[model samples]
Target: MKQKKSSQSIRWIIEVFLFIVAIVIFFGGLNHFWMRPVNSDLSKGNSQSRLTQKKFNYVAIGDSLTEGVGDRTAQGGFVPLLAHNIDDSYDVQVKSQNFGVSGNTSTQIYKRVTTDNKIQEAIKKADLITITVGGNDVMKVIRTQLANLSEKSFQAPAKAYQKQITDLFDYIRQYNPNVKVYVVGIYNPFYLNFPDIKQMQDVIDNWNNATKATVDKQKKMYFVPINDLLYQGLDGNEGVTEKTETSHTITNNALFEEDHFHPNNIGYQVMSDAITKAYKEHVNEK
Candidate 1:
């Protein structure tokens, strides 16, 4: 009886070990497939400085959207285009440095503002600092909640979002008080609606308003409503249809990268135009 009991106990231990191995294999595979890309992007952005120090007139900073996820043109990105356009139009020697990275959120920018030596130098020297952030934060939340909750259910996180925005702006202001800061708001990606697109739109709108409120509290800080420029009706304006020549509307071919989140070439052009317009206005103010 003792030997039989021992054999049974050994068999049970083997089964438990096999079960644990199977669970690990299942979860490991899931992480490898689902989480790898996100992890890779985060790692790449957090690693090092890709931007060259050329003493640019303008510096663009933020996440993947600002990193030129779209745009097939090989001439760097929209920052170069905007600089060249400004140069050609205003007859000024305009140079730009792009400090954007893929998959960064406001938190990352906040960290970069505090830690990045190159960014600190650029901020001190730059005449214009245009930034596009907060999208990744909102996107990450949406992606996480989409599995179980309705898009509208994501609205409850507004307070947390506001805190992040406030913290990000506070960090930027603490770093450079006099720098011309333009905070681009988040734009809606789910315009076509697989789920509650309207709720997502509302969430983004509230986020933008929160950003604007932060900008309003600071001197020399401006909130550029790029989301409105892209998503027209969100601000009570007529929606731009395909007939509209505005660069805001994404052509089917110019979709973002594999993540289906960032902008393509056409989208980048729209963003460049918005930045150009804001910069021109800023210059005129001075």
Candidate 2:
């Protein structure tokens, strides 16, 4: 009888040990699957800005877009908006300096980045640097080639722009090798008025592509494309990408009414949001 009681107790203890092991294995598997980190591709879709939890110095250097040309709010265009966005998203203070020239060309921007002392100091201090160039460079070519406009007309200029960017970025890296640099691309504000001229958009595409390619060749450099993003109406409706020559006059709701060239306040918001998305998606731990 005593021998039978000992056997029963031993069996009960073994059963309890197995149950505990099973429970631990089940929870361990659940934790592994639930807490797995994703590190492959953060560049595809919208990603919530990770909490940086630190202060950063932001430097804005580019063209009219950087100058807040058409912003009715009188605030510095995307620079301030982006500062505010980063401040909110990362829970850190953003001290931004705007070095955007109203109509600076790529060559002009290169000159400043290479020679200007103030911009050099800013670049040295910047944790994030955003560049808005190439739009005026594209416009320069368009103005000179409007009479005989074709895709080939932009080839040489595009190459020159690419070289300038390469050299410009090279110079920037010489001083601030590790600072993250984001370059904003050009867009076709004329697409609405001249839908028949497919080559017009082609020229713009060529410039943007050249700029993106140049940026791709460098480390810690990124391109923020705004061409297609600006094609949508402020109402979230599709803008006229496919317009016939006979199509009625379509206005880009995001563009400023006064100039129909620069982005309005809402347009600046769009730019800032796009910047935030790209920054969050590609930002590495620092």
Candidate 3:
């Protein structure tokens, strides 16, 4: 009986040891198959040596969006915000040159690139550049044809816009052979005021497509679409509101209440986020 008892005790100890070994093996396989790939992908996505550089220089040239027209803070809209984001995320010192002008059309911007010596110098030294054009170009066409507007009215202008954009890209490349360019797409801020005008959104979509097509032709150019980002105002966040005890009153409502044409503070934040994400993804894809 004593021998039989001792034999059973040894058997129990071996079974316990094997159970622990099985658990360890199962977890080891899980980590090998799952954890390693995740880590590898994160590293691969931003493995570019330049991205890891300690000092980053960002240059922004475009229209009011880059100028921060509607931003109450007067901090140069998405330009400063984007610089701040890059500073924190990449662990680098970002020196940004913002040359955003209000109500400047694509042609005007093209002209700036062609003539402005300061802008040219900035572009040459820039590690990264962001552009906010094509918005005023689209708006100009709309205002001209509003009396007899139709979807077809945009067709002719969009072609010209495309060429102008192509030229813009080519000129930038002329200055800097390797710096990446991010061109922001235009959105319809008038959608809320004129929801009945279904064709307006269509026109915006067409313009955005044209802008994206232009982006695709260049070597390292990327398009950041913020058309849907501002649409969230449709829910409860529409614009600035004044809450009253007696009445739920909306005194002023806009991503840009000052003009209802440009983006407000929140609007700029969304734009910066989108730009950052696009920048990261574009770099990764190349």
Model 1 alpha-carbon drift over 4 Å, by segment: 1-56, 74-76, 147-157, 193-196, 232-260
Model 3, TM vs. native: 0.75
Identify the superior model by lDDT, candidate 2 or candidate 3: 2
> Total clashes, candidate 3?
2
Candidate 2 accuracy as TM-score = 0.76
Pairs clashing within candidate 2? none
Per-residue lDDT of model 3, residues 1-286, tens digit only: 9899566545533443443354345434432211110000012234486477576778888887887777777667788888887777876767787877766799999998899898898889888899998877876775576445567878999999899889889999999989989988888765443333456688898899878987988998888998877765535454445557764433223366534566788788888999999887766554
Q: Which lDDT tens digits does candidate 2 get at residues 178-234? A: 999899988877645444445557677777887888899998899999887786757
lDDT, model 3, position 200:
66
> By the TM-score metric, which is better: model 1 or model 2?
2
Ranking by TM-score: 2, 3, 1
Top of the candidates by TM-score:
2
Quote model 1's TM-score. Answer: 0.67
Best by lDDT: 2
Regions of candidate 2 where Cα sits further than 4 Å from its true position: 1-54, 240-247
lDDT tens digits by residue: candidate 1, 1-286: 9999566545543443443354345434433221111101111121234132223366778776656655566343466667766666665455567777766777777787778887777777777777878877775664455434443555666666667767766766666777787878878755522222345566777778877887788777788776655544323343333435643343332244333344566556767787778777876663
* Cand. 2 Cα-lDDT: 0.73
